[model samples]
Target: MGLLAFKDAVHLVSRTGLGAEWDMIKQLEGRSQEDAVNWVLHSAASGLRPTPRMTPWLKLEPMRLNDMKTRNSAWSISQREGKLLQAWWVEQMLATHTPFIERMTLFWHNHFTSSIQKTLQPSLLYQQNLLLRRHATGNFAELLRAMARDPAMLVYLDGYQNTKSQPNENFARELLELFTIGRGQYRESDVKAAAKAFTGWGVDNNTGKFIIRPEEHASDSVTFLGKTGRFTGDDIIKILLEHPRTAERLTEKFWLEFVSNRPDPALVSVWAQQLRKSHYDIQRFMRTLLTSEPFWALQNRGTLVKSPVELVIGTLRTLPYPRESTQELLNLCRLLGQELFDPPNVKGWSGGEHWISTQTLLVRNAYLSKLSRGDLNDKSAAGVKLPNASEEQLVEWLLPVKPLQPLPTTPGARRLVRSLLLDPAFQVS
Candidate 1:
């Protein structure tokens, strides 16, 4: 309950933020855990960079049906604009003062998964990014309601095609299985009921906003989770929120993300209860997770693998080396299998051990090796100067665990730092 130790400070920063930023870790090193967690919860980066220019949905939607040439043209335009959008976010991550906000925004983007590949409208994907960031640390209940109305989500999950005559269960199925309550907790009838409730929710082509056509809505009463009513989409969401498994499912995800890959059922239940008690407040739940004993347990350190963005973006943020160009970073993300705006599928990245496949580990090491080479040899260099700290401090700073390979028997802080950067330990948190 006293001031945090240096290692604990590093653990908190690395897990919550992009990386263990030296100055950030130093600021919290002597502060109490409560104070440190509060600082992280409150300090979010303000104002995103201006969005990259994108072709509107109306202009692009017609091209797909017009002719083969126009359809090809549309694909080319989307490909171009999508790369620009990816670069825009990479730039922000590189320069942001508050990395924690960006990290959380990325977290929710995965949670409410939508992709440029499926949407084909970079502009709408951009809008969805904004919505996620707005509620990144706010109430989950509000976020779920808003996401049901989100234009990008409407397209990605075929919610716009849902109608009274023929209901599409794509969105409703994922909403129950992946987003809330998880699998096996809900029945197929619940999926059908939820889909019926969401019918007539579509996007306005002209202005790119949500629209509801009353004629397309189902008026028939349906029973959902033992409740019979002619329910609307919002009503369905409300019923789900009332379900006990909703908060607990979310807690399991947070555990896998922040703690170890394996979530302890007992702790997850307690955290979920606390989360529900707080009315699904995200910041309140994070404060609990960060301060919990399991989070600070030594055995849990470095148990989770770092995602591509964390490995690539985080290293540049923490080290003195010059960052790769935004395009290059985007390529690295794709190769590492964490493409920013284009998640592989609805489930998003598997993360954890999935981040460190044999091929990916090679790419990861090569990137660190190249980064460390720049100005690592000379402490007096004008660019990329290694920090003038003891070998022990450098090891403590760079890795959450002991170096997998032996430390350099030769004595130089720069040499030791380079060795630690490529260490297997560095691959984890």
Candidate 2:
């Protein structure tokens, strides 16, 4: 790869991973291609963080609405779930030295967006996140199936209520249109057929468990994708995962999210071919693309924008903000359109360019400015231990990049902090 191209590659990894900490970028500064690839994969030991404990129940339980207690309970549960999701993501953001694994996990979350609003349980969302993290770098065929029958998913997509007499087509339609083959790749008739096959596929009411009631399931034969037979939702998923269109759509989505925002059709084809050939080994697929010539191209670097979570968590990690200063930072996240488990919609936040709007940009500046105002101290104990970065001996620690030519006293320090926050480089990796 060319020099600038490699720099761009580093940038891509940084932007896609957690925003680059100097130590990580330095390690890959002059490394060989293979070394860089190995380094990223081995960056974390599964790197998954503990689930957050905040739930809708916790948030609303204090209110204790006599009549709407269920509603309050649900909200509290969602808040905890939301906190768990955010905490989990933030841990990955801070701890994982590699960029691609985190990037892939972020991609999968969007592709299979699940809402605690519908699932009504933090456990469900936690379980789903676990599935995404575990299979994120694995086979798509298996990944797709696991997501389809997920208890959380069953409730989120209304698949659990599907019955033979009145089959709900929501799951079938989204499965084909959004999740797999996508629109125009399959026909309306196929969706209808798929829905029929999935009837009586739902979760249990009493224990809130997965229940595949055979009697409620449609018994009649159905035609899907030119094949006529008694196919269930599982069969439809199996068929779809095996379709060429599935490979095409999945590759396109992955490329746009990870490799490039402006995905070249040819580049996507390259990945799709590899994916199909490898039976959709996720990490292998990512590894292939990361090592590809087109992926390291200069045009792909710094061209894409960072999302809210990325911007917030990235700044937090690189700056190594004190742990005591974590709460307000979370509040900033809420203001920036990406509130952890609470994605704006089923589609999730349409990140990319939207993450850096006027309002959110202002908030970002404010966040950094506040960091300058605090002293890195331990509140509980006298002459307590400092945060991770107390010594200012290192060049990076001593030198906070500032815009003004000559750094000043108090005012200058604040301006320096503001400038660091405003630096375009801070906006990305």
Candidate 3:
């Protein structure tokens, strides 16, 4: 266990918050652990300010079902939305005083993975981003139900076009296989039956809402897991939520995603018990995980490889850089393998050690150099300077990592700067 002091508390805060700066940590100095924890909780909640969403300049404002076969330029629209999505996340990471909420937002983002690359429409992807962020700290049941009907999810999972006669097993398969249950927990027969039960469950053309036509549904009562009944999608979700496997599966996921890839059985089991006790109260579960004795175990620190979004957003937040031009910055994020809301596949990014590579390291170096130098230059360029970036120097910006100092500069100061630019700890946030 780590020392429960202002310094240790600050380390905990950095892990939970948007990889916060030491100045913020110093400001939080001398407070009780409860006070610090409450500070983050209260701060995250208060920071969420509702902003009006911008309507995209859609050339095909009213899309036709007939043109679905020959859709084009939707790609551009999706990319445009991608740009806005990054800006919004950067804004959230920078402005939010609390780290738990942002951490939760990232947790939810990976859990409910829908890529705009597949969706082909920014409007739907953008809507889902807000949905995850807004409900990041809310009830899990409500969020799950809402996401089941969300357009982005529907399209990404092929749930939108599901029909009775020709049922799409895509959504039902993933519903149990990926989202709720880990692999092999549910039998193949269960997936087939679930797909049949989910037949005709789809969204409408104009207004994106759940609509199940009675004729379209496979009304034949099917047996799922030895239970015979007419199971709708909602019923399936309810049953899944009730399953012991769901809790265990989610527990494993929480361990891998938040605490450590190599989980401590005692800690995870305790968390599972507490999560069940709280009736799936996510906020409570997170609090349990974040502040636990095992959580601050020295081995667990820096164990998680930062996701692309974590690295980019966390850096931007630490510097609190001015966003004069976002196009290039977003493009750089794309180079780093995290184009906002655009995962490589339904399974999402593999994430652990895959985040590091020679090429990606170079890209990371270039990005940090951009931050340290305040360069917005390109082949054909216009420079943008951030006023605050000057005051928030590089070494201080790096305090979230241990050592509280830059890498050794004795060999070569310039090379030290370069290594600092590409440091492995920069990957974690």
CA-lDDT, candidates in order: 0.89, 0.67, 0.67
Q: Relative to the unseen true structure, what is the C-alpha lDDT of residue 411 in candidate 1, on a scale of 0 to 100?
A: 76
Worst 10 residues of 3 by lDDT: 378-387
Candidate 1 CA-lDDT value:
0.89
Is candidate 1 or 2 superior in lDDT? 1
Residue 387 Cα positional deviation in candidate 3, in Å, after optimal superposition: 15
Looking at model 1, the pairs that clash are none
lDDT of 1 by residue, 168-203 (tens): 999999999988888878899999999999999998
Clash numbers, per candidate: 0, 17, 1
Give the Å shift of residue 200 in candidate 1: 0.5
List runs of model 2 lying over 4 Å from the truth: 2-9, 44-72, 88-92, 95-100, 323-326, 372-420
In model 3, which residue pairs have backbone atoms overlapping below 3 Å?
Answer: 17-99
Which 10-residue span in candidate 1 carries the lowest summed lDDT?
374-383
Ranking by TM-score: 1, 3, 2
lDDT of 3: 0.67
